[model samples]
Target: MDSSAGHTPEPGSPDEPVVVLGVVAAPGQAIGLARKLVEADLTDHIQTTFPGARWQLELLEAGVVQPPAGDAEIVDATRDLLLEHEWDLVLCLTDLPLHVGKRPVVAHANAVHGVAVLSVPALGATGVRQRARGIITGLVGQLLGADADDLREHQKSPARSALRHRVRQLGTDVDEAGTAFTARVLTGNLRLLTGMVRANRPWRLALGLSRALTGAIAAGVFALVTADIWLLADTFGGIRLTGVALGSIIAITATLIIGADLWERGSSRQTREQVALFNIVTVITVVLGVAAFYAALFVLSAIGALCLVVPQVFGATLDHPAGFTDYLEVAWLTCSLATVGGALGAGLETDEAVRDAAYTQHPAEPI
Candidate 1:
């Protein structure tokens, strides 16, 4: 299949006023956003925002294109695409988190080269499509040489003003990308972390841990029928149960990271930051996946306890009258024990499988 298939420009004479805009996007979230851009018919928005030339938008998938280490490399890649295609301007979208020194880069534009690179993860986790459209529109305007007066005139419109506010300009001394935009400092890092986790799609992690999930279900079912487990659940207080739950989750999350060697190590300052960022995202992804697994186990255990365990026998085992809360307690305890078992079962999985489940694959590296 043609990776670049979508939104072909209309055949026109040489004197036509249409300006071709090529969107080259990394796979996963970035590519999906590119499709959304096309479906949203951003040409009308761009034409309205710029108000001069008719815009023709085309999407190109960056299949197997690894994330470059720096913004300069990103620009170089985009520039190559610009030279190879008929695009008057090229916008490269990547799920990879990009940075300029300590700041998280939202977008970068090189007016001279008529190219721009937007970091999808830097847009945060919520309102991504809307935010991306706004940023992309702004970048297009900048790349097309919209002057300050032109920008001021456009900002008079509420839509253009909002797009302008989404990304605040940052200094470009770090590289020759010409112009760069970053989110606010503290909030930006939090958003980037969340965005990275979202890109990883942690819910899929639950499905990927097939072996561990099987082990968990087995343990939970076994615990459900055991009288001793019932007694322990009844004896344990709420605080103790909560502790057990938290401990089990942490243990499993840590085990997966350690057993899979998902933790990244780096030597240089910048590399260390990148490494830390990747590790944090990895931890969060695994934690969320494990939490989901725990929740499922709890629900299943709750149902099993209610149906399989005789209320009279449970009460006799606990030396008290069993109620709904008692069944819930049993489910809670069972889930924690099952999660511990799942942690052990995770050891059965190959490192590569766990890594694949836990991380999002990028062209240059896995994050």
Candidate 2:
């Protein structure tokens, strides 16, 4: 698909309500995917949500941007970005997580201004294309006060939204919204939270680990064959052993994150902030998954070594006693070796998989 499609709109009638939906996705393949996803679904979503009015909803790639801190700031920023353009509605969809007070907000909108911004994370395990379409359409119905009765029946009231006693508005505060549709803009309820949690899948962690899988495995095998397992066990004993295990995981995860293709074409601070946050989250999730895999591999490698290699053959040359010490020693050596392997795997990882692994918002800044 042409990258230009995201920025340009098709000619339309002046009488129709022109809603320019600005999707700010991560740079590169993800942005392209975002554009395609929005273009294919925006028209149907608007029509389904609002039925009657003649509409000209255009999906624009609003470049790359990190969502601002506060809900009010986000609304103002979204409105300001589209002020130059005559728009009936401006919806900015970002990968950055948004929050109101301590609770996570799915989406935020200023109905009076006809502007809304939603977090991609809030969509939770829903496909990017489907969830993006739903949220944007829902926000449109929300901002215009169209299909209120139909939407409300399907949606929960603000009272039932908060997991805690205080039901804080997820989008814009009720008093500030200035609409009778007042029941809290996209009520941040239990259902929303459930979807968000479901969206944070473990497969993402696997993707990170996959980046270095081959190298990690090769290195483990090589280390088992050559490294002095007995000495390694003696050096990294008890609590210190845990540190070695954790270090291996961190090293591999960091390699994938640093080497992964996450650069956006935007030079803005918001772009940089979004990219930084994305990297942090990706690295952490990868670490959790990779660590578990590495530990299991280490144990299996140790068992294989103990069953195959006679400790007595190297006992005389060993600095430490063999016994059960050999098993811990071999495991530590193999784990450390796997990290080196991870580095090699990082280089071989595909561009598609890397982009799929990270949360996308927009394109990279031109060098």
Candidate 3:
């Protein structure tokens, strides 16, 4: 058995079957969980879908491979990789987007190569197991030329799976499937959704901005207690707080964007169009996130002032009155201080977290 290139010929008997699950560019966590979920009940599911066929499912994580071109290229590349192993059928799951012409496809399989490739973006926000189940079942049914009933049995039955809208194929005899796949993928606009999801992972963003946020909080607290800050707050009003929030958001966002770009430092040069899009989305996400942070800090400062302030010393300069105005002065001072502290925190942020918050296209290269 030459495991160099070309397809692995299938066994003459249908009694025993060899299936390989090849993972490339897939997230480590998702793959681990999905494999456990599928392997637990794979035999039963396979038997139900294919009746009396005995199957052996083997899992392989190939890490990152050189990316291929289009659907046909991916089919060829997947087949080539599987040729080195003894497997009758190979299911390749990749995190990278798979495109057919202008539209991105969820999955594509070649009956000739006995190989299928599924794009992770097609899974949406569903649990890893269910997404994997739907894709694998669909591939098996399509690859083996299953009867309509068998195919129907494996295809995602739940309306929420939304797998129907996502899964599609090319480079096969399924012309209608190819056309429909393109149309559905384009209409669904999964590419944009995938980017948004990638960019909007709040936990990742928070981790990236941990130091900056901490600095801001500490600064806010200090400002709430300091005499100079109170004096400045007395001189200004809501105008001062608004300015502080805007300034802080801008400073933190710029720091993240710059830091991420430096960290990523792609080998390939990005085009103007790519640069524009990246900047636009990065700015938007940062602005939205920082706005929330700033607002929360503002509320915290207000509350802290009410509880911690000795009213007489904190706002003794209101040449007019001493009700909510005093607290407002303290809040304004804290907001400004917090923004400056957050800027300092930006310097303390780790490069990795900044990259996570800023990038959607490429993973951070090892430092």
Say which candidate scores most in lDDT.
1
Candidate 3 residue lDDT tens string, 170-254: 1111112334533443344334333443435433454457788799888888778777776777777678667766776788777
Candidates sorted on lDDT, descending: 1, 3, 2
- List the candidate 3 regions with Cα displacement exceeding 4 Å: 1-204, 262-275, 357-367
Model 1, 1-367: lDDT tens per residue? 0011233223253432455788999888889888987888577777666543345788899842454455555665675676566456788898776654356668866543456778887778899888888888767765543445546755687344422322111100111111121122223346445555765668778687888888888888888899999988888899999999999999889889999876755443212223344566677789998988889889988998899999888888888899999999999999999999899889888876686577532222100
**Each model's lDDT:** 0.67, 0.50, 0.54
Once fitted onto the true fold, the runs of candidate 2 whose alpha carbons sit more than 4 angstroms away are 1-58, 61-154, 158-200, 203-211, 227-229, 238-243, 263-280, 319-321, 357-367
- 10 residues in a row with least lDDT, candidate 1: 169-178
lDDT preference between candidates 2 and 3, better one: 3
- What is the full ranking by TM-score, best candidate first? 1, 2, 3
Residue 83 miss distance in model 3 (angstroms): 28
lDDT of 2 by residue, 1-367 (tens): 1112123222343322223344445455446656776667666655544432334555565534453445545554665564444344567766677654356677754443446676666667647666666666666654443233435643454223221111111111122222322222223232432232223343444444475777777877777766455456556667776776667666666666566643322233222222222233444445555665676677777776777656776465465446776666766667766766776786678654553443222211101
Report each candidate's C-alpha RMSD, comma-separated, in the order given. 15.3, 15.3, 15.4
Q: Residue 181 deviation, candidate 1, in Å?
A: 21
User: In candidate 2, where is summed lDDT lowest over 10 consecutive residues?
Assistant: 164-173
Residue 246 in model 1: shift from native, Å? 0.7
